[model samples]
Target: MPYITVKMLEGRTEEQKRNLVEKVTDAVSETTGAPKEKVVVFIEEMSKNHYGIAGKRVSDQ
Candidate 1:
């Protein structure tokens, strides 16, 4: 089994997330010879304030 964790800023559409999971699962299955059903994808969405660059919050950029 292959497990993938994807972290990104919040506000992605449901369709985008679904497509990402499907693509990631396919990639893992193809590379590791794992079954598609055995590939697990976890998406964690964080607020813009949770991420910063140059001491400025992402939301402010």
Candidate 2:
């Protein structure tokens, strides 16, 4: 089994996330020769306040 985690700022439509998972699963399965059912995709969403860049929080920008 292959496990994948994707972290990004929160605020995407359900459809977008669904598509992302589908595409990622397909790519992983194709490259690693893992079955689609055996490939796991995890989505981690964070708020702007929890994300930082250039020594500053995104929520502060």
Candidate 3:
């Protein structure tokens, strides 16, 4: 099984998330030689306040 994790900020629409998973699965299956059914994609979304860059939280930007 090929497990893929994608972490990003929250608030994306369901459609966008679905599309992202589909595309990621396609790429993973093609490159890793794993079956599409075995390619697992996990999406982890975080709040802006929980993610930071350069000593500043995303929410503060």
Q: TM-scores of the models, in the given order? A: 0.94, 0.95, 0.96
| Best of the candidates, TM-score | 3
- In lDDT terms, how accurate is model 2? 0.98
Q: Write the per-residue lDDT of candidate 2 for residues 1-61, one digit (tens) a residue.
A: 9999999999999999999999999999999999999999999999999999999999999
lDDT agreement with native, every candidate: 0.95, 0.98, 0.98
Better of 1 and 3 by TM-score: 3
Cα displacement (Å) at residue 42, model 1: 0.3
Per-residue alpha-carbon lDDT of candidate 1 for residues 3-36, written as tens digits (9 for 90 to 100)? 7999999999999999999999999999999999
Candidate 3: regions farther than 4 A off: none
Model 3 agreement with the true structure over 17-60: per-residue lDDT tens digits:
99999999999999989999999999999999999999999999
